[model samples]
Target: MKILVIEDDRLIGDGIKAGLGKMGFSIDWFTDGKTGQAALAAASYDAVILDLSLPAMDGLDILRGWRQQGHDEPVLILTARDALEQRVTGLQQGADDYLCKPFALSEVAARLQALIRRRHGQLQPTLSHGAVTLDPGSHTATLNGEPLALKSRELALLQLFLLNAGRVLTRAQLEEKLYSWDHDVSSNAVEVHIHHLRKKLGSQFIRTVHGVGYTLGDS
Candidate 1:
């Protein structure tokens, strides 16, 4: 899943990014609330990890702005403020969850998973598409009871497709999920990954929409 982390503390931000990245999440880290808000306006993300103490703009303002603009994406507030009032204020401002500082990365990861699952109306840990199954917690993929050996990038790409199955995703949309903003993407990167995916999962799994993009049928 794609996630945006808005934090000012370099150490905390980097730790969050690395920990979440290791969990197979596509993460974008922004140090200030302004940049994070801009990113939220520009792209689609599964969730946001926001720090209340921020430069340029406070996290509460950012959260308020997103809600005013009709952004219903799940948000998890992460801050050093542990006061009950602060937690109540954050919830009133539309945060889906909150985590105080000095917490476990494992708990943060688990909470993020729960948030995303709740957003998707899922009560389970694994995501399944027909006979294919992907376990985000285990970072494993299986097809018809057999393990599927996929490269890390291929797995990420396949996860994107499976999560948005039946939707025609353009190359640009696919790139957003498969590659980060810092990566130097060539014109053919999406095609290369799609080719690799088809080679492994069978061509019938993804359908090319002539001049449009690609989509997965209800297999």
Candidate 2:
């Protein structure tokens, strides 16, 4: 999944980026709230992790603006403000979930999973298409009831395909969803991942739409 994290503290930001990155998430982190908001406007993410205190703009104001603009991506408030009113206020401003500082990375990951799943109207913890099944909580995949060995990027790509089964996803969209801003992506990165997945999951698993993109094939 892709996530936008708006946090000012270097330690907290780095920790979130690193921790979440290892868990099969593409994360774009911005220290300033304005910059983060601009990033959100420019691109799409599965969810957002926002901090209340920020420079240039407060988190609540950012949330309000996004809601006003009809950007309904799920947002999880991550801040030090732990009072009852603060929590209620954050929720009222449109945050889907809330977490205080000094929190567990596992909890953050779990909450993000829930938010993204809820956004997609997916209640099950695992995503499946025919013989292929992926468990996001465990970061594991199975094919024909056998364990599937996939790299993180490959797993992410498969997850995207499973999420949008019949829809064609262009190369650009795949790239955007799989990579973060800081990475120096090669020209053939998306193709390389696609090739690897096709090799493992059978060549006919992903159908190529002529002059368009790719879509999940019949299992």
Candidate 3:
């Protein structure tokens, strides 16, 4: 998924970008809250990594403004603020999850995945439909007990479909999930991914709606 990261710390932000990218996500990193807010207002993101303290604008105000503007996407607060009251305030202000600094990179990826899943009302780490099972941790998909070889983008597309299984996902929604702001997405990017998925999972698993979009259904 595409994630918007708002962190003033260069090291932390770079680590998050590289770490999450290795886990198969498109990332857009902003070092300050103003640029982060501009990014949020301009495009849609699958999730956000927001730090509590920021330059130009504080993270709390950014969170509050996003909520006021109706950006309900999952947000995971990443900050050095570990006090109970600080965490509570962040949650109350609309952060979907919280993580203090000095955390394991693995934990950040796991928690971020959890927030994304929860936003879709899915609690399970792995998602399955019919003979296809996707494991986020291993970045693998199995069909009928055998693994399906997939490229990163293909896997990302499949995960998005499986997460919102049975829902008609628009082209715009799929694009937002697959490409970040800095990434140059082709006009037929979603179509290309869908075509590849059909080639592997069988055409029946993904149903196309004429003049509309695609949906994950029975195989």
Best by lDDT: 2
Ranking by TM-score: 2, 1, 3
Clashes of each: 0, 0, 0
What candidate 1 gets wrong by more than 4 Å, as runs, is none
Per-residue lDDT over 31-144 for candidate 2, one digit per residue giving the tens place of the 0 to 100 score = 998899999889879999999999999999999999999999999999999999999999999999999999999999999988988888889999999899999888899999
Q: How many backbone clashes does candidate 3 have?
A: 0
Flag clash pairs in model 2.
none
Best by TM-score: 2
**What TM-score would every model get versus the actual structure?**
0.92, 0.98, 0.91
lDDT (10s digit) by residue, model 1, range 1-219: 778899999999899888877777778999988899999888888889999999999999999999999999999999999999999999999999999998898888778878877787777888788788887666789889799988777777777777676689998788887655776889998898888878877877778888889988568
Report model 3's TM-score to 2 decimal places.
Answer: 0.91
TM-score, structure 1 vs. true: 0.92
The lDDT values for all models are 0.85, 0.94, 0.89
Better candidate by TM-score, 2 or 3: 2
Write the candidate numbers in order of decreasing lDDT. 2, 3, 1
